[model samples]
Target: MIKNKLIILSLIGLSFISCNLKNGKIENIRKGELNPTVELIKVEEKKFILDSNTAPQPQYTQLYQDSSYKRKFTFLNTYTNSIYIYDYETAEYIREISYDKEGPNGIQRPMGYLIKNLDSIYIFDQLTNSLILSNDDGKVKNKISLIGDKDPKNTEWSLSYPQYYPLTVAPLIETTQELLFTGMYAWAIPDSLLEKFHFTSRIDLSSSKVSFGHGYPATLYGSEFNWDDPIYTAVYSDLHPDGNKLIYSFPVSHDLYLANLDSSLYKTFYGGSNFAGTISSLEEKKSSPSHAEMGVHIAGTDLYGGIKYDKYRKVYYRFLRNAMSDVSKDSNWKEKPLSVIIMDKDFNYLGETNIGTLKNYNWENSFVSKEGLNIEYLHENDINEVYLSLHIFVPEEI
Candidate 1:
């Protein structure tokens, strides 16, 4: 198993004609290179309801279908060792994908995953520490173990560049076929390589290569922008539907970065001038504890909802936490506002609008679909069975 995995990794690397880092190295972006915008554009929102009462509540990590959830909803039931496909409109089960625990194509501890190929999605199985590419129907088509069979995760060594870590991760879709993995606070990494690896890296499953993405500023609240603690890494990211341009939104400073393939990095602030200013100061950041003790403390009380490109309107929409409404206020850190920021492909600020308040804002449960923005709400009509509410943003013709 070890020899084959290594051979596979080597072959994948060789297949790539050339792998170049942006500029072939990671450099600190210049000052004034990224500026937040204060301009605001208005938008209209209509609500669509996703009733979860129709079936056994499905456990899904991400939503890939349209806002309507009518087309297809994919879910993974880790406890059951199965994945399900459902039709949202009729609440009908399309199909369930299941495999034996010790079979030829079994996945263990499916930790993180993202959408791929139009219908099929990628799963990160932690037990075997491999990236599994499933068919659109949820059959495990191919399995590529990222590390060695003898536990490549806890080791303290390096063989070459593009190193693979068994560290925890949250996978996000970048290109239709590629995945971007953001390390979940790896405080356990040895000192030699503690901060060496960039926070974000690309897993080119096709080429079997791992590469770096833009790292966050190192001084924002002690965790570096990459750290999930102190400031929650509520990074809303999306790629241009046409071009694979990377768009990033941080609720912490209201800064949006446009790092395209051909251009120098561009930055824009979404809300008003006070938006970016509301983030923690350098002093406050320095004084804050590096380790997140209580909860993942995002910089501003405001949190980012989600960001997506409006394929229909040809504009970008970013959901922000507006009015601080509480779900379980008695509980620590259970409030975030519900707001949206509008922008164009050029990063020009359009306007802002406020929806109601999110019950409990979990980035995992919010996604942007072709129809509208779908977010999970704990209280729907005061019923707390966990439902998804869609906020359809109609771009003002301005």
Candidate 2:
């Protein structure tokens, strides 16, 4: 069984005005005075047959649209160090990109990856502490060290690994001349750095120079907060389709932060869920809690996860983890309640709908498509090792 603590934290915004569909009629509804309902868009079940006979782990999957506008997904089979590709709607096997475990083109440990295109597949090799840019043919074109020359004396910050989500924020994003991603740091970092820590890191693809900016919201800093737990400081972001803006969602705040990549300008909007309140509270302590303890604490707390934009619907989907009544079983914490807050293109709050829980779903294996949000679904007794099942959901009128 996949650990809920790890997948739940990652695997993981907006506004709007507009119209509402009620009883099959279009009605004018002001924002903040409406409730959104969940509509079953469709379901897809596709099996991936591999020659090696090893099943692909759904936890490390990414869904992307090709140049031809066809939807496809890639799965990382760490067991074989291969990535399996499949058609999103049909589940047809496309091909597999296998990499060597050792050599000039080899990748030691791939913790996360992003696909800019078929020709530009970015993989984060944790063992080497570098990012490897490869192609669908499994040929490494470029390798860049994530760690640039920084003062060893500065305990304020460091880039150890890339933190990202497959559905919303990609691990590695290539812009005009720079690649952007968030970093994963150890919890033992100094508190002073936490006060004004930058939330993003940029690597100049040409110069290989690294820089950090887009500091966390003021709410994340200050003496009132504790940085001992990764859950409290967990942040997820995505580069806007516009190519110059970045959207950030904090685990504790209800407001979605929009920052301009070209400058230090940012604005916040109220895009919280009515079912649950914004702002999370934690115990005042110095040490961190066990994984099981953290899971239980999170189940009974209201926190946000990833915020993804649905270019197809012209809206944003922000996930909210509702507090659970029974935190007795941390093992099944994923079975707790969960919902999504919808916002318009302008970041106006539309409404929200409860989509049940992560009980049978792989949170990291979800992506946005024309059909809506496609989340990988699994049955309790599911034994099919080759095929993937997805449940699609979209916001609808009550």
Candidate 3:
């Protein structure tokens, strides 16, 4: 069984030619760049009612679609130690998966979770530094310590997604033989050493052996910018709909990266935003800036956000936070002009759709559905509302 898995990894490096659609026909242009063309999309709005006492935010929600086209998502309600499941289209309240806090099945402060299905759920426990697998009934099936005998002085790691630093994260990637998740580390180390750190860890399900690879792009080394800030180093990733490749990007660069599941080999493609201005840099600085100072600098900088793949349209979408102008130094981190860059399957730039500002919608919490891209709408005035609103963008040709 392991031999078959190794074979799949070896084939990932094989190159293939791709074609693009032009004038309603497929044409091969693999030798050079195709003429750049931008496409537009229309927006539609809808709402889903949530009768539960707890109001779930988009940052923590995970949307999953079944074979029958039923869209259901789950989010952890920490207050109740339960995971709430809801129907995406119909706004129906589904059942909740409740967990214990003390017994053998007890969970120790779960920071993030993944639901491959009702029967296969994975939870990352912060207290134990472990990953736990559970079922719909919340019965613990298996558990593995992520920090087994690792020296913290040399390296620190975590799977928990900080609530404050919201990133569109996939808690774990599950295959027939392995499970994978992007790892985060502390920034206390020197810039030279930190730049070489690996950002992914893979665990063999059959053997429970953990290994790390998939280092950051070479462009990250010796850069003028200070990547110590989480905002710059944070990654937004999505798995290809075919489940063979993992596509990810950093907030500091416009490059989109593809990491093969079987090998350390990877590839990169240009995916810069049309509206993104120059990203701010901290050059020739003798000391690190305060957190507030860093936040203020990043506020006026053009940075990228989460990346999503729309299987329905056979394209990808990435969030672009446009640079703010004439901003006050005292101004806290707030909403700014935002847009979504569309890319074809081959990472070709399609077009960008401006979606107003972050105040109106939550791009961090979004999913690609049959209707279009559903982004959560923020209701500032009615904080006690019992429903979740969304803005759906439908792609259209110009």
Candidate 4:
């Protein structure tokens, strides 16, 4: 009787699987009507190559150019929570600053930036929720806490609110004497209220003040899904060369929005439909007969992003991973190739490039610097043993 019952259960499971296979069909979710084929223009060989072993595991690097277009300095963020300053003209590591000790908060994840005046360096500590200002000698001069209880509705008043998560910082852009920086306040709200969610603020370096700013409400669009559940998301913004416009990406809607401090016009580009399949019904259909969400999975589920405006090409270099295409029945999930997409400033589709077959690979962060396009991915020669690898891609032409 037991054997018969087991057979019956096995048959029922197979029947359910077959039914789901028929109903849950995979669909392609990438955006843009124009599927323009982008041909890789091989202009020149790799002119500069920095092996990972030689330098500190480079998390981020920025190339500073003088008014004459000559490279001045290369500021590097090292894995050791220290900022390494290299004089490009001298081709040497001139100084290193350690912000980990002096501040009230610990410096676990340090994102470094050289201020416009070229005198001070700002390090954003992802672990401590604070910003550390230092000099060329690595001495901490000032510290700013990004988190506070100040309510935007009551800007004049201040309160005490407990910070739950660490802060992520962006590079500071200058206008005249004042410097500007952007960051997000990580918090949770009801799914129904996600659309009204604007958990970010702007900081003025001179006054040492932070002002709450508005952000794209992604929860309004994906109301049916669980927006509260932490999925992959990032908030990234860049200042135009002239500092007139700030271009930023909000992953929830998979859209790029432009904000002009001068005009106060905050508009989203491409109607927030640049990338395909940011939202999926797979989680909702887990018990359903059809696994429709399977189609949206490309390779990685995270919304890892690196965006830059290419003046020469007149295009925006935006890179992110697609959903995992292959789902494994085995307990272990394996790595696959990543899809890199390039688009115009207006979010028009240019073309897609596939970085073929990377093993034990996980992407952390990416950025566009004066040196070229740099991406940091967790990679392993053997499956299971993974380490961070920083890859730099230079444009074919000089």
Instruction: Report, for every candidate in turn, its global Cα lDDT versus the true structure.
Output: 0.46, 0.64, 0.65, 0.45
C-alpha-based local distance difference test score of model 1: 0.46
Candidates, ranked, lDDT:
3, 2, 1, 4
Residue 84 CA error for candidate 1 (Å)?
A: 2.4
Task: Please give the clash total of every predicted structure, in order.
Answer: 11, 10, 0, 12
lDDT of 1 by residue, 351-385 (tens): 65554555543334545556554544444454553
**Two-way TM-score contest, 1 vs 2, winner:** 2
Writing each residue's lDDT as its tens digit, candidate 2 over 125-192 gives: 76666678898888899887655533324432254333433332334566888888765333433445
The local lDDT score (0 to 100) that residue 174 gets in candidate 1 is 59
**Candidate number that wins on lDDT, 2 or 4:** 2
Q: What TM-score fits each model?
A: 0.64, 0.80, 0.81, 0.65
Clashes of 1: 11
The list of candidate 1 runs beyond 4 A from truth reads: 1-70, 88-91, 99-103, 112-120, 127-129, 136-139, 145-171, 174-177, 182-196, 219-231, 261-277, 281-300, 322-331, 360-363, 380-391, 396-398
Instruction: Name the best candidate (by lDDT).
Output: 3
Off by over 4 Å in 3: 1-46, 66-69, 149-171, 186-196, 221-224, 284-286
Residue 382 in model 1: lDDT: 40
For residue 246, model 3's alpha carbon misses the true position, in angstroms, by 2.0
Query: For residues 105-132, what per-residue lDDT tens digits would candidate 4 score against the true structure?
Result: 3455665565443446666654455566
| TM-score winner, 1 or 3 | 3
Give the winner by lDDT: 1 or 2.
2
Model 3 C-alpha lDDT per residue in residues 77-142, reported as the tens digit of each score? 666777788787776778888899879999867666778777778777666666788988989998
Best by TM-score: 3
